[model samples]
Target: MTGPRSARSGFSLVELIVILALSTIVMGGLTSVLVRQQRFYRGTADLIETRSQIRQAAGIIPSDLRGVSTAGGDIIAISDTSMLFRATIGQALACAPVPLANRIDIPPLTLANKNTLASFSMTPGLGDTVFVYHDGATEAAGDDVWVPYGITGAPTMSSVSCGDLIGSADLTTPRYSFPLASPLRADVTPGTPLRFVRRTRYTLFTASDGAWYLGYCSPDCAGSTPQPIAGPFLSGAGGTAGVAFTFRKADGAITAIPDSVAEVSIVVRGRTRGIVDMGGYKNTQVGDSLRFSVAIRNRK
Candidate 1:
């Protein structure tokens, strides 16, 4: 007779242990990769958002602060933590007619119903210290503290009283090299590079017309303030105002405002959501750091 036999279907202890160990190793590797990728995606999202914010914030001044000024002097004050400055406003839309060149019949720059300085603390620049008819030379090395324009390198003319505007000469050569007490044929040095050319000066007659518009200037374009500059870029066509600057420090023992704050440095905070591993835990660090400068377009 055969001896009694017993059967067992379950795995051996060693086999089960090996299988568990293998699964653990695979899981660890996948977790590591997921963590790293999640961080990367979050960082990318934050960066894109920051870049967009920088662009929008930076554009506010350069594009609009062409001629911003105030009667109490050029006004400059920061608006908020993310944004900056909220200076008083003043500017007009006037009809300036040039004599000739491109768009021979563009019409005059129409004045706006009211004067809005359109001044804000969006940009920071040494240019704030500089004025349309400033009395000094430019610093070719450091900043634009007194970047002289005059009829030389930049605009010198005031209003487009006439229909004529300036023309494009060689960038390599500048026509007038100094400020003038007044405008006339004598302001420029005769040659191919006309310091001043005759062109059309268009304006936004009713915010509907698309040539150019007038800006406002207080008690005259002086002090530390900005004059609104609407459209149709022109030479010597600048407005002015006074500038007052302040700073905010994060240090527990906050020190006095730094002089270097010719511009305001801002870290714009924004949010974005996306599918990512470790969703909250892994990407928390990714959504926070972006910095851009909101300089005072007019920093003296």
Candidate 2:
């Protein structure tokens, strides 16, 4: 029909097929890379979340243990998953004029004789239990024993003056106003400082959801149903041996007596979240553990 048909300006079937094959290869590589990146991001996120949870669990344990009472028989019990002990709610430095009776007179022990009327730490609330400790009498050398006495009452600010104990007013020393649960077994000597603390029984239990939680009660562990302190935890996951405790005496000997325990070593172990059972690829669960020791100051 025509002298010589001009070569077609469009690609031939062979060229089109080749171009399609190359595009398929490039797209396959891109898809593979995208999938790999997605997996990496997911793994990283899981690790970070798990570590955060571990840190939260670890931080709370020490803070609670630090407040343990130093009085004899303060620690009620200790086990793999449970612990009961007394904790201090408030403390003061010194008691100058002594032989305290039903009331405690708190003076300004601060520098420059500053009146710490509102700064007293032992303002007990209702349903609160307090323990008084006399720090003056020396039972023996280096045997600073704190004589504990229990109290149960709401505290009030007292301004009336009685005997040598002076109440802080517009021109007097401040004092803690509360009724003692009972009179001291013996007199609190002069220059002997006093300490007040609240005792609580803390129990860590495994909930129905397979998570660990902290529960607490007042006076004694068997008095009431334990209420959770914060939220669920993953610290108790390792079957029967997940959580453990070891006690030591002040003389550095292992002791079973709860009162003689000066140091407690706690160990917690568990696997991170998002654990999978894929063979080889996810053969084992990523687990972490936290171990630390708490020195019971009062017991020691």
lDDT, candidate 1, 16-61, per-residue tens: 9999999999999999999787777776665555445434433544
lDDT of 2 by residue, 72-99 (tens): 5657777666677655566653333335
The TM-score of candidate 1 is: 0.29
Give the worst 10-residue stretch by lDDT in candidate 1. Answer: 194-203
Model 2 residue pairs with clashes: 70-298
**TM-score of candidate 2 against the unseen true structure:** 0.66
Clashes, model 2: 1
TM-score per prediction, in order, is 0.29, 0.66
Compared with the true structure, all predictions reach lDDT values of 0.31, 0.58
Residues forming the 10-long window of minimal summed lDDT in candidate 2: 162-171
Error of 2 at 25 (Å): 4.1
Candidate 1, residue 60: CA error in Å? 1.6
